[model samples]
Target: MTLWLSSGLIFTFAAIALILYKWWDMQCIGVTPVRTLVFIAILFTSGLDVGLIMFPLTEFGGYGNVSDNPEYGFANPLAIEFGFWAFLIWGFYFLTCFYFAIIEPRVQFFEIPVVKFINNVVIIGTCAFTAYLLLANLPWYLPELSSDDGVVPAFYAIVFLSIALAVYSSSKIKYVRILSVGSSLLFIALIVGMWFRAFVLGQGSPADFFGTASMLGEYFGNLNKF
Candidate 1:
């Protein structure tokens, strides 16, 4: 698994390097050209999901226990968490966007009927899986709303409503842009709110916050190990 992951990382970087070398000054215009901020907002929202927001707290303990999980010993738990969520993982998205924006029009490989059908099927499957993840994790986050078996109608209703809203929003590009930018702003606000709560309202000092954040430097310092 590690070898496979290493190879993927190497390939992603190589592809990114080649793309940059070939089109250093080229602008990527999408089907509908939007401002730089909207483009970034779309990418930011599309590249992440609720799982990322909820994953670290659950995995941090395992990552920190290097004695049991020696594979994670190369870096601190914070570093491991950051490495999982950021850095080279995002390169895959970059490559996909680049391909669709720059290469797909020329090749038209995805325009084939079978390929388009398969692509849409994969997209629908992905969305279903994402919704399932939310449904499965909701009980843990909101135990009060869950039954004894960790399943409840309320959870199902919430997930159904979420999917319904997402489908409705996706019917138009303007709705997608609005939701993407709004969600990005909301995520930023969430981060700031948490930081303020932790350092300002809570007992933790500003220096403590910085000290905790600085632990992420281990990931950068030991990038090759990751």
Candidate 2:
């Protein structure tokens, strides 16, 4: 994982510097899915302090058990893990977003919400909370936060959405059915497509996950050697 864990980080850190340079000169920026994905990917790579309460239990159950350097005597191995997971992964991205929010022109993404009852309030709230786990993981030095706080809410959102889906499927209400069924099918299609491409086509293992760097690095490795 040298190319992935070490070299890739160096590449992204340089890329972030390039983006910051471009942002400085361009004065106008376009938001794209790729950019956002890259940005979030960086945060997930670098930051971790905010993730103290984001999981049900320890993120790395046994990865951090062995000491990296016993002679040096580091305090917590998990904080070191967070250094990779949350800080390196998403920290710069969050700061960049903050910089954009303050410096750039913005669009209003809001509409009238007079009829809150008519919307996916529970779904939206739960999803937002899930994302907040990443943000909270940003601080990286938070004293002590319960991982259950984020996990429980995320579980609630899943349960609520599941129930809503169950009801929708059973009733098959005209409008709801269109969206629910279509989205469900679309989601399944995407999952199947990616799964086939990743594991079957690429012959990747559990480690062969996430980022263009990983995909590109594994091109020859994932092939039929035998």
Q: Can you write out model 1's per-residue Cα lDDT over 110-208, one digit (the tens) per residue? A: 999999999999998988988887898888789789888657899999999999999999898899899999998898998999889988889888888
Model 1 has an lDDT value of: 0.85
lDDT for every model? 0.85, 0.47
Task: Tell me each candidate's TM-score.
Answer: 0.87, 0.29
Q: How far out, in Å, is residue 133 in model 1?
A: 0.4
Count of clashes, each model? 0, 23
Off by over 4 Å in 2: 25-52, 60-75, 91-158, 161-226
- The sequence of per-residue lDDT tens digits that candidate 2 reaches over residues 1-226 is 5546566557777867766676655533344323443434433422232353345134444434556444212324344444434434473664556455544435322233644443468656755675555445433423243364444354446446755664565463343435444554554687788788988888775565654334333323322210
Q: Output the worst ten-in-a-row residue range by lDDT, candidate 1.
A: 49-58
